[model samples]
Target: MAPQGMTEAALTGFRQQLTGDALTSGDPGYDEARAVHNAMIDRRPAVIAQCETEADVARSIRFGRENDLEIAVRGGGHSVAGMSLSDGGIVVDLRRMHTVIINPESRAARVGGGATMSHLDRATQPYDLATTGGRASTTGVGGFTLGGGSGWLERKFGLACDNLLAVELVTADGSTVHASEDENQELFWALHGGGGNFGVATAITLKLHELPAMSMIMLLFRPDSGPEVLRAYRDFVESAPDEVGGGCIYLTGPPEEFVPEDLVGKLVCAVLITYAGTESEARMVAAPMLELAHAAEMIAELPYAELQCMLDDPAGMRNYWSAEYLDALPDKAVDAFCARSSTMIVPSGTQHVLFPLGGAAADGPAHYPLPWRGSPWVVHPFGTWESPADDERGKKWVRDVRADVQPWSNGAVYLNFIGQEGDERVVAGVGGDNYARLAAVKAQYDPDNVFRLNHNIKPA
Candidate 1:
């Protein structure tokens, strides 16, 4: 049912104002339009406004407000919590507005709000320039950056928000606003790891860096060797240069040629060492891991954009993910991290990942709301399965991983990596002081909390 204030005539008028198109219950593509990345989320928004221009976004917000409809913003439709959709409300779908404009001379890319990582990366790859983006190419650049984006390149270039130069947003009242270092400075600060609480980001400009080459060395071992491999990985990354990045993961080996038939469809400890340099240089840097006994190996130099899509988890899977920032990864923590992998739903897309964080990521701006940036390591249990029957088991395994690492946890987390845990986790993700400051910004821009679907910062 439509909201009390909304009527058929009002919706018809709203559709007429949109340059794109409005999708309602009876619309031909309503079901397809409401489908997000996670198959578990099945929300049915009363209306989905596919915005083509900044003007369309503003008009959608106004229509939602006028009709007292809860507003949900959709970018890449990758919010695991389904924050991009609202039941019987309004969704401002930005997928149609994907337009990436790259300026090679300035080393910058201006991306439309709804653009995915592929859109941004493909545009910049031609110029040999790139920015830190989400690990998945399908992730929305707006949500990823605003939530403190992390990726394979983060150790070298820093988090996505660190590369953010400017943003153009549509506020709750349907007014346009621009944020940058010298303009709307407060709002700009809030955008750094504050999530999408301020407004609907119509567009964002990111600072890019030149990259001539990229290489990776992936090695897989028996799961029993996980502890030793993880311990060695922790020590290796501690001294590795900013250009060196990747993670130690426990996963069901895929049916790739490099993976032995025996290891495929079974748990294996995999270590991937990525370098922003040649294959020879990567081999030299990853020598320690290479010496380990491994069942499979794949070493090659590839384009950064191509590498970004290598680990893309298939869509339409039941997804549940959580993360923890660790102050240290001692041998005991490594043991605990590996031990929990036994509970994981294997032969599936689930990943028990341990990412080393340092280099430029730690050295980025200190005043931003992202308190987890300085943590030396992050343990992410990304759970994805095909069956609803495994939901309880998948969720429990993720929670257990968090519990196992709590002793070394810094209490700060990355919001983009987790689902709706609770309000306290929100405070922990963005610092207590930072949350208070962000609430003030929220009060100014969205006093009514119209954009409350994300990691919400309540208005002051």
Candidate 2:
């Protein structure tokens, strides 16, 4: 099954139309092709094929299946666990397939699976419309949606997967099909939260929302003040309307133009407040954050797209991440955040963020494919490091901190923020009966578990 002896001749007919690069085991570009975002993952994929079109994607899947080669699908290649590449397998590099088509009348955008947050935001901003996306601009739309996307707009609109209208997928058997409410509805449901177990998505059609340009009140304070800030954040998040959502980021202050020179590189808590309202209305809502601590750069009235990139630039950083839903921000949990902030963060945007999961979107039952919804917030530890020697230290810091807050949480992890955890972790992400139901659905669509490469849902 290892494709070691497979020759270039096997894929000759399919190779003619490829405008992108295809490197085999001994090809000069093989190592570089297999190298994903994380340097820690050094997989020697049998073939790394960067595709330029949907046809190219179909071809790659066909070649891999014919040769019994395992498959890894790479969009923006940001998987912390490096699931984007497989050892001695084939990686369908869709990064070159970036395209965006907006239907203003339908309020929808048909996005190439390879597109990033930047692509979606840039396209939708002109129409004063957007949808749920990751905090960073570099994360891929494909992986994010497949894992149940959540963002600042989530509390307003809904989960990224919830807004998904349709998906064009090339399954394990190398057949292309469309997934939507009208057709293949079951498969569509699974892809919303099923990870990559069923197929490789070539394109996604997402529903957009009318959005208002708003304000950003970024507050920073000493680590000692983190507890009070979290409490303030809790009160605001619990009461704020769907028009608002801002996360609490506890981090080591960066030596940036905005941060005070004295506090640069020092441990601090950053409360990033974002709301879809005018300066006056936004300020009234942001009063909670101001009460928590001293304001750093509390500016308002910006373009929606600019405000979308308020967090650090997502590229070039080693992100070892995980997330969980919290029932409430208990005083003890707040203290735990403060304690972790005192020393754990690495310099340059290293932090822990508590993203608000409240809004009209969160007010739902198990109606959609996604599960965990009762929790009002999600706690995430985004561990960043500079050197390989420090990777374990950073991972352990996040792991320990996450464990410390576990008892106070709802025992469910948000799929989008999950990295390289086990099947048990994925099941926990769906919560209670949702996993069993998902398993039954998986049995129907992907019975052989040919798509076991992702946060897998084994067939019942």
Candidate 3:
């Protein structure tokens, strides 16, 4: 049956106008095209327009609006809340637009809106250049950067938005526009952390930095030692240099060769120290965590691109994640974080992670919409499981983690790290003042709020 408001003739005409495939119910590739990274979200959009170019993106948006279909944009399909897919709307899929062009001399990369961290990283790695990218390889550059991108290299380079040079976008009216330091300046500022509220980004230009080498130290300890280990990790990060960045995590130990047989499949407290320099420098900087007794260790110098892929989570798993930015990581907060690990579904992909933000990440432009930049620490409960039965258990664990550390919370959050939090949180993600300004920008570019699937910023 044709979707409501979508006639067979109209659907066929829409397909004829696109250079890419348009899949709908009962279509050959419809199911696979609609599947997002989060297994829990199984929405069936009336139409999934696989856009291959900027023109295609504009056409898709116009078609959705003209037909009164809710519009969702799909880049990497990694939105934990599945905002990229709509239950019965039109999805403007940008996966086919994944292209990366590097300017070696200028030290910049013009990345396609649909490109993933792996795509951008690999393209720039050969030139010994990189920018802050998402923690996972599969994360979409569009959503990540637009939502204040964070990652291992963030402290050294800056959040991904800090490196943004320009963005080519398709606005609500199906018109193409460019946002940069000079063009559409207000929209550009909003684009820093405003997310996909204004339009569909067809391409984004990011400033890159010279990254000659990258190294990391991974130390695994017994779960019982989490409190003590986290305390020390906290102190270490407080004084760690800009080149040093990583996280202390409590996770189900994977069965890797370096992982001890006893620790595998069990919850373990592990500290990862990522260094932008050599292994020697990394070891020297990470000496504090190295002193702690560890059951397993892996310290090596590797390509920057390879390091970016280390935390790649497998797709097709149920996911629910939330984060709390903290003004400080007091000992009490440390204990609360460790205590909550017990509730996490073990033998699953759930991770109780604590990342420090300082140096370049916090030092970036203060005028942008990002509110989490100044917070020194962030407690991220990234819960991933394989069963529907664990849905409540997983979600509760994430929310409980947020509640546990609410005392020290700065009330600011990174929108990309969370999923469908209320409007208040959306305001908190970007400061109240910034939200008002972003809404005005939304009013100018998307007054009707055509793009509302993300952590939405309503138009003024």
Candidate 4:
């Protein structure tokens, strides 16, 4: 079947010009093609173009514009707002284009736009080279890095965007463009954290660093010890070397063999200490937290790729997440953060997390739009559940946490960690000055705002 609004002849012509498959409403895998990471989003696009190459992406974009249909870009289908899918529109699905090429000599990797963190990490692990990536292994590298990527290694190596070496994109007019420090420098700056508002990234090249050994210390404690434990964790992180990174979190104890039977399915306070070194060094650095009483402990040195998948959330679950960056984590602020855990929906996959920033991330390029990089700490409330009945409650809990932390908020947000809040929040994520400059770039590359599904930067 042809697309809903497109004529049969036009649809056939577009399909013939592509080296990929195009699916319509009644196509064999139409339903599967439209599915994204967040189950809460249920949009049906008029056509789904599974692009296999950069040329396919250009053709799909041109086809969508010619047919007067909204165009959505899909990379791992992980946008929390379901921006990857659109109702009665055209979706450029890039999952088929996922490919990673590693260059050990230059310590760099060129990743396909649709590749996931797992794809990037697994490819680089063999070479003992790695870069910053999202906390989840299944997150799209394009969306995550462009939206100011943050991860367990951010403090040590800076954000994923900081590692960006170059990008190959398909513009609004279906023209190919490349951006790097020496070529298309303005577009290169915007791509750091400006997001998909600029264009469709076909591939991105990232700088990698040698990571010989990585270790982690995970300690689970009773909820009552949250205040003291969080305070200690904060102090330890403040004085620790940049090689140390992790977070203090409140989560439902899992059924893993390491967790005690009694704590399973119950709320617990946990502190995860990640060290970019061997197990012996990690143990010595995390000794402060080890001295405290804990119900369960897991300490070992593992491959970086292995650690990236340890907390992977299963797909198809309802997800709503928000974040607040803080200039400080004072005692009172820590108390407020822990107090909100009482309202969290227990026995679920939700996590109330506090991540420390301010190492290499703060020292990175200041010209980029990521204003949140300067923040010393961040509180991210990740709400994931399996039922629609708890949607309202789960969303409310996330909002309540944001409100509780407002007293210390730095007013900067990481766009990747949030859904569609509003336009003002978009301005706050990127500084007011940076937003204007990004708008200018948008006008030059996408004057009509063809790519507006993301944290939109309207043409000037």
Question: What lDDT would each prediction earn against the true structure?
Answer: 0.92, 0.78, 0.93, 0.93
Greater lDDT among 1 and 2 belongs to: 1
| Residue lDDT tens for model 2, 247-321 | 888877776677898778777788887777677888887776665548366567887677766664444556688
Between candidates 2 and 4, which one is better according to TM-score?
4
Q: Candidate 2: minimum summed lDDT over ten consecutive residues — where? A: 310-319
TM-score result, candidate 2: 0.93
Q: Show the lowest summed lDDT stretch of 10 residues, model 1.
A: 1-10
lDDT of 1 by residue, 1-460 (tens): 3444578789888888999999888779989999999999998888999999999999999998888889999999898899999998999999998999998989999999989999998899888888898888899999999999988899999999999999999999999999999999999999999989999999999999998888989999999989988888888999999999999999999999999999999999999898999999999989988998888999999988888899999978999999999998888999999999888998999999999889999999999999999999999999999999999999999999999999999999999998899999999999998888999999999999999998888999
RMSD of each: 1.1, 2.3, 0.9, 0.8
Question: What residue pairs clash in candidate 3, if any at all?
Answer: none
Q: Write the per-residue lDDT of candidate 3 for residues 1-460, one digit (tens) a residue.
A: 5687788788888889999988889989999999899999999999999999898999999999889999999999998999999999999999999999999999999999899999999999999999999888899999899999999988899999999999999999999999999999999999999999999999999999999999999999999999999999999999999999899999999999999999999999999999999999988888888999989999999998898888878878999999999998889999999999999999999999999999999999999999899889999999999999999999999999999999999899999889998999999999998878888899999999999999998899
Candidate 4, RMSD to the unseen true structure:
0.8
Badly placed stretches (over 4 Å) of model 1 are: 1-5
The local distance difference test score of model 2 is 0.78
Selected candidate, larger lDDT, 2 vs 3: 3
Per-residue error (Å), model 2, residue 125: 1.1
Q: Which segments of candidate 4 are over 4 A away from where they belong?
A: none
Off by over 4 Å in 3: none
